[model samples]
Structures are given as structure tokens and as C-alpha cells.
Target: MKAFPQQPTYTGFNEPSRVEADVCDLEVEGELPLDLNGTYYRVGPDPQYAPRLGSDIYFNGDGMVSMFRFKNGRVDLKSRYVRTDKFKLEQEAGHALFGAYRNPWSDDPAVQGKNRGTANTNIVFHNGQLLALKEDSPPVAMDPDTLETIGNWDFNGKLSSQTFTAHPKIDPQTGEMVCFGYSATGVDTPDIAYYVVGPTGEIVHEVWIKSPYNCMIHDFGVTRDFVIFPIVPVVSSAERAKAGRPTFGWDGTKDIYLGVMPRRGTARDVRWFRAPNQFASHVMNAFNEGSKVHIDMPRAESNMFPFFPDISGKPFDRERAAARVTRWTLDFNSKGDTFEARQMTSLVGDFPRIDDRYAMESYRHGYLCVSDLTKPYDALRGGSITGMFINCLGHIDLATGKHEEYFVGPTSTLQEPVFIPKSATAAEGEGYLAVLANRHEELRSDLLILDAQRLADGPIATVHLPVRLRQGLHGNWVPATAA
Candidate 1:
């Protein structure tokens, strides 16, 4: 047996595991609402082999898709690995043949020009197909029921962009999906491709454009009339990686750029707005009013990934660079001004979400995965890295700026909460929030259901797990009818 290398990436929740399970009629702490009939799908990175380079990042791992099916007041669980080309290649080799994250030059000679993505970041369900996404490569379609890999999807050969974004937005009313790809052709390339998928899975639109610079454009926003792309300071360079430096880093000299392109037009009509340097990973929602587009999100002062340092090698202070819910208004009618931004609250958090129905329209409530102020987040590797565990779920009111939170305690960690309305006619924020919570004391995890409108009151129902699975990332509640 090959001895596995011991590294910080393999400790705690990041540790690799090979566990697939199926259980039925799980025990519940309270009542599992009968109306909450759907599947909760989540994706996480779980490396199958000890890294070939002996040092690996959390983002570099094979994807595991887990689902909880709810029906008639009962819940069933199932999980499977997303068998990507890289995963299958390593599986046959009986070890890791690839190298550093997405940099191909670091790979073993035997696996030259092999697939680079693990497809582990996020999952989306549309047109009855469950697709696993990683930004560097095209989406891999998976069997939603058995969670089996079908193959990569390129919109039946219509997608020209080699890369695809994980954060695609689905319009609630039209059922259309708005997606884009940065570095669309190759590593560190400055090209971007904006794509649209229709209600029936047709490739309705696509436009190729050049970004201000090659940067990590992770998440974007979509309103009724436009698509919003924020090109921030965090950037990647294959040339720098060939010299054994960090693949991605912050360069303070680069100005943050936001490209507002019309939903029906090409790059020629795109309006570019310049803003002060900042980093934003996610956006809650956006809407188009008369002459301006309003976008709500969490913005950070500097790069949040401690693993990737700034080019100047300046030390980072997390407390000083805290991320908060903010609003950025882009006004086209202003005589001389193009944009304005302001922090909405003092509370700090990330992974903001809203009710899907109000995604591109005016919405009142939003939720976030915030650090529990009482416990205080712990840093590892001599205060060089952070966010091994997060502790609370926060709810904010965009109209009044008042908010509340539900803490899971010091030992437990909470993933991003998925919001679903109580019913079709339910008022805004009148719904349930599904949370995947892990308790460190018993090493067990649970599915917590809380009233979205009254988050501080705590979970109304808790589904005790049959096994203690490690923490996972972004999930969604798919109604039975939709699935």
C-alpha cells in the first residue's frame, strides 16, 4: 500500500473519504413538513487519492453529490461521486497522475494534456438533467436518480466556449438559464463567453467578448434586462505558475471592473463601469429599475482566500477586511456618475441566497452563512489560513436593514441555507430554510429545518443522519414537480 502524505488539507472536514450510502425513513426530532416535498442536492470536494504533489488545495478534489429525497413526511438519503475524466484516469492508474489545481505543466508526464477539472464546485438541475460544474471545464451531466456520470455537456455541440461557470442563474418566470465563462478558451486568457439556455434546453444565445483583464469571475447577477459580471482583483497566470509561484493572487493595482451587457445585445453595446478594488464571490439578487440596476451582495476589502497572497506580499488582516452585505447601484442616467456602492450592515458573512421566484425582481429577505460572533473563527497554519468551520445562519431585511441569526453552537458548523416558500401564495420570506449542520461533539450531522422568517427561533425540525458525513457546499431544494 502506498503511504498517504500527511498534510493540513487532509485534516478535519477536508479529509478524504470513500463512503456511499442509501437509507430510508430517517428519524426526525420534530415534524418533517409534508408540504416540503423535494430533493436537497449538495456537492463537495473529496479527494480520492493523496495529492501527487504532496500539497493540495481544498478546491482541488473529486466531486461528491449527495441528495436527500423528501416525500409524504419522510426523508431518504443517497450519495455518489461525480466520475470525471480526471477521476477515471486516476482510478485506472491506482494513484494521482495529475498535479497542481488547474496548471497542466505540473502534471505527471504520463497524463499530459489530460482533463484538469474535478467538477466539484456546484450542481444545477435544469430540464430534468443534473449537471456538475467547475469553471475551468465544461459541465458533466449526471443521472439525478442514481447520481451516475453520463458525460460532459456542450449543449449538444453548440457551446463554443471551452469553459463554463458554476453560478448560472435561472429566471423564475421564464425558466431560462443565464450562464457565462471566463477564460473561455485557455488558462489565463482574457476572453469571456456569455451564454443563455432556453426553457427547453436550447442554446438560445452566446456572445464572445474580451474582459478588462483575466480574473476569477466566480459569481454574477442577472436582472430582467442585463447580465452583470464583476471582474475583481484576484487573478491567475500560467506563466507565474510555471515558475512555482501561486497560481492565483491579488494585484492591488488592478481596478475592479463591472460589465453590464444587455440581455438581447452583443458586446458592442456593453457598458463597462470602473470601481475601487474589492472582491465579491457571490450576489444575492439584482433588479432593473427605470434607469439603474440594483445589485445586492457581500463585498470584501481584500482577497478572502488566505492561501492565495497578494502580489506585493502584504500581510492580510481578516478583521479589517471583513465582508459585509452591500448594495451597488449602476445608474446609466446619471450625468457624470456611473456607479455607487455602500455597506448595508455591520454583520459579516458570505454565501447569500434569496427565494428563487424573486431572483431578478424586487425582494425583501436574504440569508447568509455568517461566522458565529460568540465562538470566533479559528485560523490554522500559524494564522495563515481561515474558515475551517462556520457557525451561524443570518437573515437580513433589505428594506429596514434589521436582521437576526440562528446559531448552531461552537461545535457545530452550518452550510449555506436553501430557502423554499411554504406555499405558492406564501408572502415574501414566509418559508422554510434547509440547513445541513454537523455537530462536532458526536461527529454526527443533521438536516435542520427552520422558519426563514424567524431564524433566531431555531430549527423547527431536525432529521438525524444515519452516518456522520463530512461537510459539503452549496445546495438547492428541488420541488418534486420540478425534479
Candidate 2:
């Protein structure tokens, strides 16, 4: 029984120590309009959801929605409702916790604040219940239609301090849900691994990820009998802080390995596969093909660690480069195992799927957009075309390896694309794509829509938001038809 950290000392999730000055007011505007007709809805941070430290409170501040809006030629926001639940902030037994540490962005050494509460993953729907993964808390399940919390599973009791990234994968057949969590002592670590919450929300399955290397299971999904995950065998800041580990580069190489662990088998029975090129990156989504699997990613040239230091206003010396789309596939036959992959698309960035219309079933086919945003503050630091690019909303034909860039963007910082499917549309077969763009210089967020198929032509309508949204992590599209 590993002990867990108290609530007040945690910093990740929706709870930032303090709100940045720029996101305070929702008055910022973008280069484009905030409305699209075919898309049903676009929901993200506004006055309701932005991080709060003072007397302010969030309105529609919680929950997640579809990353893309529609299948139509002209995109617009499709109206749909989303719900999120606040995390539990209790200090577990026998753990040391503190509040008010030095602010990441402030120069004041005495500055302090409450530990940030967990910002849950874009909630997922399974067996008539909506489930979400929170950073510092447990897995919670809610109603997709009503957004009412229906269940929760605590990981704090299982490990000392744990955090979750990306959405948990759901087993479509068994009705069981799966998610990965990392636990450490303080901010740094000698961490343990655990899997929390089955799809039904009653079981807290403790997962043991075996590796000679340090295992950090980030984003993953589940198939009939195996839990597919991309593991980064590396140490974290907490581990470094405790072990006195110094920062260095490719000086020590970390391999990004894919492991297929049996759902009911022990860790020793897990079969592992390693991707050839080690890119400092995150696994967006994996397309499962029975024995074979395909992975989609935003080709990162360098380690993702360097990008973290500059998050607190520090300068990160990085090549302002764009990531390409690459696919890795593995086929496990009765005789043996085989691996094959290729560069799917170039000039593209972060991808999210709206529906099953794309060539590959994973994020690669969802919404493939292009941007020059290699680093977080690259645009804020006066780089020309920093906040620029075009967003193409449509399905990529994996067979042809060609992306029909429909909704090409001249927009700023487009976000994960969500599909609203034609079922949510009044025009029969016409569907929409909903996207978020930070057009204004001061972190103003806007909702943009496009015809899912006719995206290259441009958006039909757009909705400019009067609030700000968090810039990292992933979200999803929850259909209005869902209850």
C-alpha cells in the first residue's frame, strides 16, 4: 500500500498556483470569426473555465467536448453541453503536504498558492456513463447526457502520489475501461505504476508495467485482450530531485517502446515492441488492427523535456521547427511479430478525430492541421508567423496517404479537432468540424467551424469567445445524441 501526497501540495491538473494576468478577461479576439453553422458546438475555457485563484469562479468551466465539429463544407459551432467534476482535495493518512510554493512565472520568492486541482481528460462515454482521467485525483464517471457524476475510483490509496495523462481507453466488448497512472513521493520520484478503474467503474486494477528502463505510460488504448500503451522509459523531475540527477540531452538515449500487456495476465507476460526513432513526443492515438497497430504522432525532433523549462517564462533554446505525421504499425501473426511504418503527412501538427470517416481510425485521419508552433512561447517572443497556419478538416485516406486539406487555416493556434458527425446535423448527410483558435495576442480563444468534407473551401461561421482556455492536454467530442 503506497501512501499518497496531500491535496494542497499538488501543482498539475486544472489547478495552477495562480491565474496569468493575460487570461483574466475574455476580451481578446482572433483573426477569424467564432461561428460556423454546420458544427453543433465548441466548448472550452471562457470566464467559466479559466484557472481561478482569487474570488472568481468558473461558469461552464468544467468538462470536455468533441475536438472536431462536422462533415459539412462550411464549418460552424454545433451546440452541445459538457460537464466536469472538481477533484477531491483530502490529505491521505501518513503523508507530508504543504501549500504556497514559489510561483513558476513570478520573480517573487515568497509567492505561494494552493496546489492546482486536477483538470480531467476530455471525458469518455462507456456503458451509458461518462468517464474522465484527472491528474492528481481518482478516475470519475459521469452521465454523458446529464453530466452528473455517477462513480469514482481512488488511486491515492493505491499509490503515494499519482497523475494521469490523456484519456483512458475503453474496452468496447467487455464494458471495462482502462487508464494509466504514475505515482511518486513529491514532485520528483522513484515512482510506481497502477491502472485505475475498469469501464464499469467498480474495479481499481493495479497494473505493473515491466521494463529494465524507467516506465512512464502516457497515452494508450485497449483491444480485446491487450492494453496497448506507448511507454517512455525515463526518470522524472521528482526522481532526479531525490536522486540528484542532473539534466542532460541525448547524452543518454531513451527509447519509446510500445507494450502489449495481457488484460488478465501478469506483467511478465507482456509483449513489448520498440519504435526505431526516438522522438521527444506524446502518442496521440493508435489504430488497432487485430494483431497489428498503427500509431500517430507530431514528429518531435528533440526531447520534450527542454520544452518544459521555458514554460515558466524561461527561454528554451529550440529550433522553431514543425512536426510531421508518422505512422508505426506492428503485425503479430501466429508465427512471429513484424513492424512497419512510414511518414504519413508533412506540414501537419496536432491531430484529433471527429468520427470514423478518415482513412486510418486513429488521430491521423481526424483533423490534420498545419502550424509553425514548435515551442509554447515562440509567438509571444516576437517570431513572425508565430501564430499562423491553416487547419484542414477531413478524413485522410490511409490507402492513398493523401490528406485533402479542406478547411485550410490562416488562423492562429488551432486546437484538437472534434467531429460532430452528420447525425447531429439538420441537413441529413452534412456534418461539421469544431476547432479552437487563440487568434488574439493576449490569449483570447475562439470557436471555429468547417464543413467536414469541404474544409479546404473554408469555414461557414465562427464564434469568438470572451474567455481563455488551457493550451495543453487532449479533449473529445461528446455527441448531443448521447445521454
Candidate 3:
């Protein structure tokens, strides 16, 4: 009775796998780490039903959360769909009632005023709650042990903002979560809300500011003293939404603004630094030295998302879209409105991660999913959901300026890599990297564990999964004691 479209977004490795199962004691290719006891939680878009408009982007799918439980010397698997309002409405109707990504006008009339969040972007464990985030709405809290949807959480009704960020940074020292939301009031609004949630999961501080423009603020950075918000030109307008166009589009004419404010300061203390048009997301790490703050992230010359097309009708330039790790420096000591940016690594990739313990501090190591085009790739086997071939995992040493990589086979691509420290007090970069690899030919997936310091040595253990997980956006590792 259900037939998804045959378009590329619904075919190959991108096809929907609406499977929710609990498989105990999954098969492991190598010896599992006895001390590695925790859960790796990840969420990705997996539509529960066909789109009402006959087609939809991959990002608009329902949130499917997968967890791998590690204990003793073995691992188990459990997965479930977050019972979001959009998913519940579609389930009741036996088809999709919602129409497009962030486009409320395309939705069914009966479902007006409903929450349209997919909760498909990222998952994090904090304050004894597992939060599934989508950026467009408040976070959905799930039971960490059972993966059961508890409901939408708004900091015990203390959060007044309508939206929350997916990429929240937890301070290693204070254990506080630093996050922000753009278009906080509504779509096409320049209002941005910044919050600092204490370790007990209460919003201890809040501030509101206006962005230079209404655009996408996918991720941000936080040092001990400051919060950094980089607003690019992937903008939204009410006119575009009313006209039935995409909610957000690339605008190359506008300048990028980097707004920096004290972590505990008010909006009046915020400083806006301007830069030329560019694209950056997913903060790798950020730190400060007195009045100078440095934020590290992948920087691309133009828009990286092909789904959000150029507003000026310019074709997406793949060459300019390739991103490399770059460091942005903002000095409050200087009286200039501009910041300095310098490319740090030649390794072209995104979805960057680092030892979270070194977060908000000067760090030397980082990890990311890499696309090495010079390597062999069998495009006929399967194409990437992002339309780019991401065939490897990379590690960069900022202190030494050395780049190392572990290349997956031609028939495989990778998801974002998460770093797990070997121990609570281990030295920086002395840890294990856990990443999911999509096996195109096999139509399955594998969770790989590699030594972070020796990535070129390849996986030490591979946890095999019978089902292929469609491309996921982000995930994190939760220690057993914390979970």
C-alpha cells in the first residue's frame, strides 16, 4: 500500500529503512574493548511514510534514533523512531500530512499549528536526559536506556524560545551546555536566542540578539569567556515560503557576520565582526587567549548544500564547495569590525569533532569525515546522499600541522567520527574513534573503532549491522557512568 518515489533521494543507500528492532549481542569482527562501556547514540532522517507532495528532500524525513550499547566485552543494538508530532500525524493518517522541509504552507490544513520538527540532526546525553535535536524546534527528550520518546522538553517550561540548537557544546570544566537558536521567533526572523543550561539541565542564563540577516546558523562555538555565532548567507524569507519555494536559499550577495559576546554577558556587550560571503558550519573547537578568541571549523568558498540552491540562479560550484579546516580569529583588542581567517589544513572535509575534554580550550587534535577524490571510488555502486564521495576518516594535528587518514574501501563511505577518550584522565588525542561506514555493495553498515593517534593503522574493531542506516547527520558517545 506504500510506494516511495523512485527519485535518487529515495533510492540506493538513501532508501528508507523503516525498521525498529532490538538485536542483542551483535556480531563483532574483532575483540571488543572490555573497558569501553557506554552507548553511541545517533539519529538520522528516516521517513515513516511517503511524502504528501510525492517527493521530499532527504533532510525532511522522520527522526530514527539508533543506539549501540557496549558492556563487558560485547555490544547490543536498539533502534526506534522519535514520536514527533509530524511523525504521529502521518502515522494516524497512514501517509505524510506534512509537505516540505520547514515549509508550513505545504502542510495539510488539518495539521495547522503543529510542530514540524523532524528531530533528525543530532543526539546528546546531558543532565540525565537524551535529547534528539532538529534546530527548528525544541529538543525531544528520550529515555537513554529504552530510547522511548518522553515528549518535547523546554527546560521544564523555563525556555521561552521556540527553537533550540542541535550542536550544543558542553563545557568540560563547568559541565554547562552552551547553545543558541536562529530564527528563534519564527521563520525569516533575525532574532537569535542564546542560552547556557547548567549541569542540572536548567537554563541558568539567557540572552537575545539580532543577526545581521535571517539565515541558517547550523552550529556555533564557545570558549571559556565568549560565545561565537557565525551567520552565513543561507537565508530565509517569508516571501519565499509563501511563494511555495524552499524556506532557505543561498544568497551570495550578503556579507557573513561573526557575532561574539561574553558567555555570561548581556546582548549590549555583543560585538559583530564582518567578513565576505563564505560558508562554514560545525565548530571543531574554540578557545581564547585573553582578549583574542579562536574558533576552528571547516570553511568552504560557497554553499555546500545543493538542496538549498543559489538565490541568484547560479549553478552550485562543486570546486568551491570543497571545505577544509580553517581557524577564525577575533581580537577584541583591535578596533576593527573584521576578523582574520586562515586555512589550517589541506584535508578537505566536514562534520568535524575533537576531544570534548579539550573543548573551550586550546586543543591540538581533531577528526572528521574526508573525501579523497584521488582514491578509487565506484560511483556505479552507490552515490552519496550529499552528492559528494566521502571515502575516508581524517585526523589533524594542529600543533604539528600533520594530517593523517584512514581510507575506507572504494565501495564504502563514512559518517561523522566521534572521539572517545581512552580514560577520563588520558592525554589529549589518546583515545578511540568510533564511526559508521556504509557498505554499498553489501547494503549494510559497520561501526568502526580506530585508535585516534594512529588512524592510518585502520580499525581495531568493527561492529557489523545487518541493516544499512541511511546517511546520518551527527551523534555522540555517552559513558556508562553518565548514561
Candidate 4:
């Protein structure tokens, strides 16, 4: 077998590993907690075959699923590739057939009409089934135990939207999941579809809304009564794509649009509020204050993704872009279509995660993965595919404006930290933080289970893996009992 040439972006910490272990008994550096018993599942692009385009971006590879199963004071690691229609077709052909990252117009005619989803962005475990989710298409259902692809699921054919969201929020008050899809009808369209999935895994509600411009709305926020849709300046044009011009880019003239609507309402009820020219890819959480809405997220001055350049062919100076957690408050009582944006803290980082048990409610503390101090900020893909040498994990008190951090040193990097509660009755942040750390200098990975309440104290247990796992997008924690 010929070895695939290493793509420079895929080298270092983003390298793809073909190794799949059924059971891995990792060496623990510290004491493992007895009460922690759940599986931490993550998905990332790990292409099995070399790209036909010679070189590809980090987000263009095929989806690879990894698992860290905890049982009875022991940890077992396993991984497998998601068997998608695209993967099978490529496997049968023995080469790549897909086009550029997301421009289907660049694809070969043979696979043009086929599904373009890699299902590589996020992982979700709902109603006893695991789903590999990408924002471009319907989620591919998989067997959680064996990591085998069941098939493409469209919520029993009731999902009218062509795609689903990578970030879906499960309501704490009601066991319903609120999700939405941008460019839902087709790529480069302003169409958006909002969906609600019941606890039993059925499509409960569906509504169609359109953004003011065709933009990549990757993530949104959900309050008890409302859903917040943030439409930034990063946009796409099918005409530009067909002409071989840039498909996605930043438009400085466009102002940020926040569509605040009732969770059970339609597009006509959506009240659009305009904010400054700020861009945020992810939202932490949102809540209602009667006629007012508060949405919290990390805001950057401009589009941080340099790979997807502006249509003008001008370079985006990533050095000018830095992310800080900010809060945008929209007041309907003011009788206007404007909002107040305020910087929450001086802490700068992405992936602001709160304890899901308190989601949609008044939450207290949250955690974030910060960039490694030793490396240049622009060295890590500007801000596109982060988590490579994001060496620090931070905890913030939402009420007290207090912050604490754990630095893994300059030798290692950490992925986004996911919070798992200790028990049903445990206090907020009285749980464990499951973070996958990559020691790129040593070419190895470790799953660090840190005490959330004692975040500054460092990991309580570290499960070391034999290979360096590529940094991924998002994942979840599924308790043993839930399965």
C-alpha cells in the first residue's frame, strides 16, 4: 500500500490516524473517580483515503468517531470510521470524488447529486441512538455500542429541512431538542428551518425562516420561551462559486442580525434586531427576562476563518481578530430593532460550555478552552479549526465575575471541555470536566477528567492513549444509565 502524502495542515496535531482499537486500557496518571460512569464520544474529520484535490482543508476530511467509555473505575477507548454513502462510494472507487470543502459545483459530475454531508462536526446521543451530525445534511444514525452506521435518519421522513444543525439544545424544563438549519433548501440560499425534536426522537415542530443574507449560521441559542438566531457577515454565493471565485467570505457592510422568535412560533413572528459588525460561531446559552432576551457568546471583531476568504481576494488580518465572551441584550420594550452588546469578561477563548442540566435556565458557572500562551495566536489556523495547543482550560463564575484556570503547560494542548454533573442533586459545577488533551511534542493524547468544582487543581485522572487523536469539533457525555 502506498503511503498518503502528508498535507501540511494535517501534519502536527491535526494528523489523521487510521488506528482503531476495540478496547484500550489506558494508563491512568492519577486516581479515577468511582462515581463517573459514562461514555465521552467525539467526532472529527479523519480521511481514510488521500484527497483527489491533492491538498485539502482540516474540515474537508471524512468523519472518524472516537469513544472513551468509563465503567467501574476503569476507562476503555475505541474508535471507528462512520460508514457513509460517500465513504462507501469513495472506497469502491479507491480515490476521492468530492469537490472543495463545501462547494458542490466543484464536485465531479458522478457524485454531484449525492449527499455532501461528512457528518464530522458533532456527535449526539438521543433516544438510545448515536448520531453523527454535520450542518450540511441529515444526521447519520449509528449504533452507539459498535459505532456502526445504521443509515441516514430524517426524523422518520418528517424532517422537511435538507440539513440539520450541529448544535442542538435539549431543554431542561421539557425534554425537547431545539435545532435549526441554515441554507436548508439548498446551498447559497438564505432559507432557514427551525425544528424541535421530542424526547422520544420524533419531529414535534418545524418552521421555515430566511436570513437577511446567505451566511453560515453554525450555532444558535435557546431560552425557555425563545430561540436566538445570530446572522453575521460571513456569507456565500452560488454565482461566485460557479465562477471559481470565493464561495464564503466576510462582508464588512453587513450588520449582525439577531432573529428572536418564540420557540413555538413561525417566521412571521421572528423579530429581527440589528447589532454591531460582530461575528460569533457559537452561543453559550440564552434566557428570557420577560420582554427582554439575553444571549451570551464569544465575539470576535471580524470573521476569523482565513481559509474562506472574502470575495474581494483581500487577505483577512487574523492578528486583528480576538474572541471575548460577550453578552447581547435585546429589549423589546424599547420599541426599536436594536440591541446592547457588552463584554462580559477580559477572558478570551471559544467553546464556552455550561452545564446542560442548567441549560435554558439561569446558569451560574461555565468553562472555556483558551489558546496556548507559548504559540502565536494566528499559528492555530487563525481561529478556524482551533484546539491545537489551546493549552489552558478556564472556569468563569457568571454572577461573581470571577475566573480560574488550569494551564497544561506549553508542551500540550486541550480540546473543548465538556461538563458532566456528579449527580442529579449535585450543585452547579459540582461535577467533572472531560477534556481530551494532546501532547503534540510527545505525539500522544490523554483524556483528562478534571474536578469541575476544583478546576484550578487540575485533572483528577488522566487516561493516556497510545496515539495522538486529532482535535475535533464537538461531542457529548452519555451516562451508562441513559444508554
Q: Count the backbone clashes (under 3 Å) in each candidate.
A: 0, 70, 0, 0
Candidate 1 lDDT trough over 10 residues, lowest sum: 377-386
lDDT by residue for model 4 (1-483), tens: 335566566676666786667766778898888888888999888887776666767787888899888877888888888888788888887878887777888777899889978889999988888999999888999999889899898888898888889998888767788998899989899899999999999989888988999988989989998999999988988887887655778887789999989899987889999977767888888888887899999889877777777666667766445677888999755679999888877777888898988888778888888764554333333233332346688888889888888887555678888998887778888999999887766667888999997888989898888767888778888888888
Sort by TM-score, top down from the best: 3, 1, 4, 2
Q: Give a tens-digit lDDT track for model 2, residues 285-344.
A: 565667676666555554344422321333433453355666766764434433556776
Provide the overall lDDT of each model, using Cα atoms, as 2-decimal numbers.
Answer: 0.83, 0.44, 0.90, 0.83
Q: Which candidate number would show the highest TM-score if scored against the true structure? A: 3
| Per-residue lDDT over 135-186 for candidate 1, one digit per residue giving the tens place of the 0 to 100 score | 9899999988889899989898988987999899988889999999989988
lDDT score, candidate 4, position 341: 85
Q: What is the Cα-based lDDT of residue 439 in candidate 2?
A: 55
User: Model 1: runs farther than 4 Å from truth?
Assistant: 1-4, 333-337, 376-389
Most lDDT-accurate candidate:
3
